[model samples]
Target: MALGTIFQHDTTDPLAVITAPSPNESPEEKAAREEREAEARGISDLIDEELRAERAVRKKEEGMVKILLLGQGESGKSTTLKNFRMRFARDKWIEERASWRAVILLNLVRSANTILHALSQEMDDEQFGLDDAFTFDDYYRRYRLRLSPLLQGVESNLKRLLGAQPEEIEPQKQTHPITLSPRTSPEFFVRSRTWRNFLQTTRGPEVSGCSLEQDLPDIIDSTEAIANCKDDIKTLWRNDIVQAMLAKRRIRLEDSASFFLDAIDRLSVRDYEPTDEDVLRARLRTLDIQEHELRVDDDADAPKWKIYDVGGSRTQRHAWLPYFDKVNAVIFLAPISCFDERLIEDSRVNRLEDSLILWRAICSSKLLSRTILILFLNKIDILEEKIRDGIMVNRFLPSYGHRPNETSEVVKYLRQKFKDTVRHCSPEPRTCHIYTTSVTDTKTTAVTLISVRDGVLRGYLKQADLF
Candidate 1:
């Protein structure tokens, strides 16, 4: 019987002989053959549709306005990028929260290690222009015996979790072989799935046979200890000896270390999920350019925005050139709070001074002259805090003559300075908009992003003859 007979009555008439093919062919065979052909044609049509859709998507992307984020390292480029994701692509950002756990842990552990280093330096009298506040021998002895072990434990844990550098791996080859260094390896962040897996693991990495501490603590460990022992950490941090030593060494402890220090209790919990603010505060040096495609609207006709964030270190500046020609606009972030700070790579160079020079280079560059330039005078929150804490702007920047050491005064002075720098160096002498921003503040940053999007789109639409 023919399969078609299952769906419809099988009837035969003498008139049907006009459509009959061969007398030897069975009705069932012809029915099954026609069904298979139908399926093949349906699949072919679906495939063709998919190919056309992909081509259309690619074509749309080619016209998407590309915005390049440019600034010095630690200048909040990554944080601004995070703001865009949170505002426009919340679903994807939520999905990646787990991966950021490792980064947050890494930042905390690094801060602890830095504080320990400073303490060690004080013990050795390595930092000049510092008087020993601990006249009693027991203060030194107790801190050394107690805090030293904790610091050692933290460092050992960090090394274990991050994996050893290529050179250090051979030394521990029997235990854990050379994979990649999360702290130093540029490729690990961008390419290594092994590292990414380590980040996503819930329980944390298994420590090898090295029992430096009874149990290697995770981020939770450091946070718990710091929180429970808040008084101890605070006393140690604000001790005249530590403060004087930090000041002499010009270490910006507040910027680098305060995030973990401030929220020690909250971060220690095993069940703790990182909030948007936590993610913003979490510091990881971006080692390469990251590009994210954002959908401004759900409609298929909506436009796409391509945002690029590149590493801003001195060596990383070379990578910026490759992206310059393609960008429709550039958002340059200069952390104005860094006026009193020095670059980590070069202590002699003032951070603000370095930023100004980088800005000048960018503005004057022939490749970027026609590119829309928007400056974010970023980290205003930190600047306001520093001003309140009695950090005089003129002390570091002598050019600011007779200005009051207040937030409003400092902002005004810096704004004028930035505007002057742009005016003096911009190759095209066009008006550049500057925004005082704290990238960590989502609501404010989101609003700023909206304006920025509109401005960039206006310029881009005009260029594309769409306006």
Candidate 2:
């Protein structure tokens, strides 16, 4: 203050005095800086509010659905999954617009011993001990670590086959000559002599030692040699006979060992060869995996379902019950054509019992309450005239405590029975429908829908708004 006062000089104009203040002047300059800081803080607060609004809009774009399939073993669960995957993979909407992540194809069937052995060369300790009590999560984790590699192997083999060059088609090795045990029967010696004499007469002396006795020693050297030669001759003979009968192209085996090896190789090679069944299973698995992915992230894009391949195992079917609680619809498979005229008789009564058990199992499940059940009468392609006559149908009804023999009548009876079962099990009853499906040679003949009942269970589901 003393220094300031000493430096101060009187000025006539107030403006001049104000301008004359040193650059180091303090309190007034500090007040001006505080005003600028408050304005910057206001701008930052506005930015954060706008960011949250944008995120809310993004979250609204995503939706998800979960579905479960349940059935008995070998009821075409895998086939259904594969078909669904194929359909989805080829979908234009998903392909052109969506950010398609990789498909996670998990096969619960792999947990089954039959399928696991088929897919892998050897089983690990965990695989050997899989049980019905095992949960889907356990299988999913183990499959990721262990079974995924086997799938990669399958993919690699398929790629190699697809990329094979012309040079890869080498001529098959010829089968080693097989040595027959010395003819213990006199008839064999007589036949051999006659054949040898005939060959010598027509082809000259060079063919003299070409019989089994002479050629076997040169071809087979030890017990191992004979064992190896066995399959070679069998394969060569089978191929030759088949080609002759079919009068078509032939597959020649190089030798016996090769034939055995080729058989083993075929097991692996066939996995890469896509069939109708394979395509179906892939589609189904893809659908399940996609659904699981969507559920994990609630903010994912709405997923369109491609297929529903339900598990057919008794244990797996139990696991699938909860999934039905979330399903909007259902597809039921019935092999009506599997019924035979023979099944009508008392001697074949077990067939009817078995059929009833299967139907009861399906209808008794929790699915009856949650989804629209569509029954597919499969194998109609092989339906016989006797079955269509409805005699067998009538015979079966009495055993199940229902009226006998009218096809329409039987269907109505079963439908009512299922309805009652569902009502007893679920708090609410829903619409159930039936359709007769068949496979035919022509595409035009495939997938004929016989009938649909209007609002049968539709009203019930609508009233409840289960979804």
On residues 361-423, what C-alpha lDDT tens digit does candidate 2 reach at each position?
Answer: 655665455556655544444444344544465443454354545555555555565456545
lDDT of each: 0.70, 0.36
Name the Cα RMSD for model 1. Answer: 11.0
Write down the lDDT that model 1 would get.
Answer: 0.70
Give the alpha carbon lDDT tens digit for every residue of 1-467 in model 1: 67335434334655444444444568998888688879999999999999999999868767787889999988999889989988889877775565565456656655554555555545565434333444324464555555554454554454455544555422322473323211211212322344434444533234323232232346556545545545565556657866665666555543536777666566656666788888877765535567888986576765688989888888789889999886788999999988877776676899999999999898888888778889999999999988888888888999887878888888888788888887888787777878999998888998998898778878887778889
- Model 1: lDDT of residue 216: 36
Best by lDDT: 1
lDDT for 401 (candidate 2)? 56
- Give the TM-score of each candidate: 0.73, 0.35
